[model samples]
Target: MRVVRPVLGAPSWVSLIAGDLDVAQRFYGELLGWDFEHGPERLGPYVSVLADGVPVAGISGVAISAGTGVGWTPFFGVKDAHEAARRGVDRGGTIGVGPVSIDAGRIVIARDPDGASFGLWQGRAAGVGDPPRQTGVPDWIELRTADAFKAALFYGEVLDWDAAERCEVFYEHERVVLRVDGRSVAALRGLDRPASEDAPVETPRWQISFAAPDVDRAAARAVELGGRVVRRPMDTPYGRTTELADVEGGLFSLITPKARPSATAGE
Candidate 1:
């Protein structure tokens, strides 16, 4: 439940690919007080989501289509994407996109056995890693799946990460904490199906959490900026947080960390 910094297995980078670039810029800019700066010219409208002039995540402009999945994707830093995809395939996950080249790094869009999507990145540019979540930065990456242990084992063998610890509050549901080199990197938790819920339910997916300075204030700002607040701000032992969907329907959360009570400050 306590997070100090980012380790190798945790989310090193995160990004959102949506239909509208302008909407992404305004919504995230106001919500996180982010400064969206253009990336390389070839990327075309792709921008770095920065806080205090530090790159935290990315916002890419992708053509809108019925099949497009608009959501924040977590990318884990790896030594090599090609090798990671090879090991991922051996562990039962499928490669959805590439071990393809990009301006900053090589990337592989991968899915776990239970259908949760994640990314693997081997960055070539500097400032790609080091430093963890701070204000206006990505705070956490979590997997929500029905088979918590199954997903844990998949990541363990595929990524050499140990999803080993059970969280304090969600112990009944099995919250597996991912650790890399003795440091907690990310976490996975089992999703509950209400008894009255229908079959053919929505599959589990990885979610992105952004560090916020003020929970209620951010939640309100999101609504004013045409975003939908799925869950209003609520206090927790960790911090105050709320779920929100961007104008493009990409889901993410804004959380105020307990470590810094006033305004925001990251890895």
Candidate 2:
């Protein structure tokens, strides 16, 4: 029998720090059908969220003194956590946590030059588990930053990710593109100054995007399911998108492609 190596180089893993783990678990569980698995070691009061028997995300207990706000921390796959941390620090980033072992992986938390925090995971068991495929679970990660070009260069140099193509949408002021070896792994969006100033700077904190087959239906269902619709569904050249906040107040988005207008039917 051949041992199956875990899937690698996909960007879909993220973490959330919750004031109450039970409440956070309940919200995501009801919303995404995630199963909470508490490790016996109990790495500093955090539990892991698993999907399809694989760890996909985590919920950590919040620290009042640490002044860490509750939000999602996206993790990128890396060959070596220590080396990544060194490069991040050299480029004006700061390490918030260790190249330390937690569960089946070694991860280091670091902030970008602009003070957005993200994680670098060196997998010992499997690489950030498997990609999500169902509704409610995260399917895509988007980084809305001040400088999309700088972010692209920073991540490309650090993680070896390549930009597949670049395009601009009417809704966005700057260019947006999908980055991956070939498949659509993630997106980079340029940020406006006012938005960036009001956003959290310590961590690469941003709204998570959930894959929805139908954008309008998902937005409607989110409201009916106790989530609040922060932004109405709108069509963009890239895709249709809507924003919602979970019952626990965690914000996320749902995206789908726009349909062809009747004016373009003949074309």
Candidate 3:
């Protein structure tokens, strides 16, 4: 796989905090055909997830018992971790962890105003690379919040995304699209989720979608591997998509990307 470095404020890495590292590894390894390698020691017994021999994500077993829920968090690259964390807080977000030092770089865990958790990293992101969107690597990352416009403002300020030189922001189909150097990287969608007296308020979160060659087969395999299909496979712009919860109930989606035209066509 070709390694491509990410730009400032772009997504750099993703990770899941699982209760049992062994079970998480086994489940994903079998389900997504992924390989694993030991992550930086400073991160403490974590495993970097590799899809087609390229690092795509990480799974850490250290914080599950410390009240951290099992969920996937996307990390964004930052030129300055301290400034990013401060900007997030200034923009109505909250910092849960630090701009602390690690072997690979400095990191900060924070949540947007809507309570969507995300991370900020300042360093030469080692595991960030350009791997073809496949069954294991993330194909898309989205933030589902109550107001996309409001959320966009918060992120734009925190990430300094308004820089005309490298980034572009626009709205489409009632959602805000974030593009880095002409390529759509992520989106923010406003959702109307009504809460009943009995139903608890749901927190906004960044959703990660992994690619699948066959969505239906992948959903079935998830069930066989002790996962639950939250949403049956259905056609969408990203191709047939299915929402799933891992063995530990960490939610993610599977998307079969739409095929592109062959480059040699019309030759």
Candidate 4:
């Protein structure tokens, strides 16, 4: 599969770290119609996920033994790993891993002040790139946290997003949208309060979404593969979307794009 490089300060890649690498691979491959390739030796027991002959994501067993939670973590592109990590630390984010060398690049995993986990990569990435919309690839990312503006400020400084020449950050509705080259790649939104007394508190984290052809059918197949539905499919302005957890409890969402109405017959 061919690889594409993401623009600096944009989302570069995403990874699922699990102790049960085989099961994780099996679950996602079946759920998302993905293929796998042996990943870089430096990543240790890793597999690169391919969608329609293009590398889109990865799975690794490197940090599971260290008690890292099993979840889909997003990595943002950076010009300098060390500088990004330093800025993140200065802005109240905590680094969990290193600016260590990995095959073609350097990476550092860290959590924002709100405890939302993310990564920084300063090299060629074989995942999300400019105009990131693609089949079976992670298509959208959202940060659910207590404060949207604060989260925006932290990421903006750490990722050097202050320059309008590269990207633009703006508020829309109740969320902050991060746009690169005219495309909105991610959004930071405040966590909604539980609607009733018995609802569970939403956790602060980056959520990944994949485009699926059939929302209901795909969700059903996920269940047959041992995954659980966190939220039943529901209609939204974007599309029909559902939240789900892999067998190992990694969270992600599936969204079927809202169909554009066909041009009026013989208009």
Candidate 5:
């Protein structure tokens, strides 16, 4: 019998917290050509960004927390935010924040069974689709967890996504692919190195990767703009990636593909 496959879902939107909103705006705007759409300045110090007039993501000023640093939060598109949150709770997850409205969408923040936090967006105006390739904004979301299997199962059941495939890649170790419908939405992988003094144990945080036509150029721009390069750009089997941190210590990465299919191409 021939096996039928489900349609892959598109990634909707992603967000991050800025330690310094003004500096982040200037840096991302200059680097990615992102246009900042200031919401009511009184919206408790949050700013939304638009790409080609579409709401791509938002950033809010975050205070220093116990475990989390100033980092990006990526949201997956769901049909109903409340339902997803409820399912997450049923599956041994906890709600971190809202089933509440922010701008055009209703979002609920929840943690998986293994304590990985994620956002579910029932978008009113912004849908989970592929990000613009030309812009140097978030194009992919990856989860680095201690237990990839449990994380995969928790998200699969909670979000109604399916585990697409499990493949071992030499550069990043083994990766378990998850799909919403048939579309590759996110990846779950185990850490290569244990947390130590230099490599502190970062909490289960989402690493948001910005698309760069040239990883070297993006890394250079990040350094020139007062952002520090945490990991120098290097070619891996998957892609060319370099870790970076803003002047205020928010961490993220710039990635240019070396061999993989274009993430925006629905691969």
Candidate 6:
């Protein structure tokens, strides 16, 4: 487990909001080499995913009363969840859920002005390390929205993210990388219509991507484990990627990153 200094405005933790705790735990445990540590369910049906005896990520159940969608949620670190929620309100963000106290810390679920949902985690939980970036752990996140510039501006005001002006134009969409503390942590992608083609409009969404050394192998493994392969591994400018969905319809991706440039000249 790696220890990381608190980086405000960067993703400190990522959690899946699942419908069934058992199924979610089982699906991820097998795929990500994680084990579950259940939390007090009275507050929320929360569980921490541990890998090699280190807490890596979390899964929580949305109150049936509220009726929220189930998927992965990224939480940014804050000193005080309540105060952060207030600041978000002052900055035009909406607090969708509580600054409720749990055994470990206080948390608030919020939506940025662009209507992208995220979380604010204010206190440190015991024994939780920085989530791993190695193969099999969740390593990256991207927000697919209608307007990348407005989305960046809205979140920049609330979280102080240094969102880049330049967007990498792809065939179907445009992507802008977001940096915090001088490091790229997340991305904002404009979900535009496919080039010169008509397609159904898609709502904005945040997608979670896990890392793999061999994305093709990972995609095959996912199919063997009762998951659906939405897209086969394909080479892109950035990496090799395969889109997949769990048995219960939770969408995620596997990526083999592109090699970084060497500082030394080519041999």
Using TM-score as the measure, which candidate wins?
Answer: 4
Candidate 6 residue-wise lDDT, 1-267, digit = tens = 122223455566777877778878777777777788876763468887776766657788653434766677777666667777887898778888799876657778898776778887766422222334576666667888988877766666555544312111222224676543233446788774654557566567677777778889878878888888977899865578888888677778878866422122111
When summed lDDT is taken over every stretch of 10 residues in candidate 1, the lowest stretch is 164-173
Better of 2 and 4 by TM-score: 4
Per-structure clash totals for the candidates: 3, 3, 0, 0, 6, 0
Candidates' lDDT values, in order?
A: 0.68, 0.61, 0.78, 0.79, 0.64, 0.66
Residue pairs with backbone atoms closer than 3 Å in model 5 (clashes): 7-182, 8-182, 8-183, 11-128, 11-129, 12-128
* lDDT: worst 10-residue window of model 5: 1-10
Estimate the lDDT of model 6.
0.66
lDDT-wise, the better of 3 and 5 is 3
Assess every candidate by TM-score.
0.80, 0.73, 0.88, 0.89, 0.77, 0.78
Candidate order by TM-score, decreasing, is 4, 3, 1, 6, 5, 2
The superposed Cα distance between candidate 4 and the true structure at residue 196, in angstroms, equals 3.1
lDDT by residue for model 1 (1-267), tens: 112122334467787887888888988887788897888742345888778777777877874743567877888766668887998998889998888877766778888877788988776322222235567777656688988788877776665554312211122224776533233335788774644656455468987778877878888888899999976788854567888999888888878755422221112
Return model 4's CA RMSD, one decimal.
5.1
Query: Least lDDT summed over 10 consecutive residues: which range in candidate 3?
Result: 258-267
| Model 2 C-alpha lDDT per residue in residues 12-87, reported as the tens digit of each score | 4677866667777777776566798886442356787776665667777674335676667777666777887887
Error of 6 at 166 (Å): 21
How does model 1 score by TM-score?
0.80
Q: Measured by C-alpha RMSD in angstroms, how accurate is candidate 2? A: 7.6
Model 4, position 163: C-alpha lDDT score: 54
**lDDT for each residue of candidate 3 in 1-267, tens digit (9 for 90 to 100):** 112233576776788888889999999999999899986754556888888777778888866665788889988877789998998998889998898997667889999998999988788633322345667778778898988899989988888886634567887657798765455657899764555677665568998888889989999999999999977899965467898999999999888877521122110
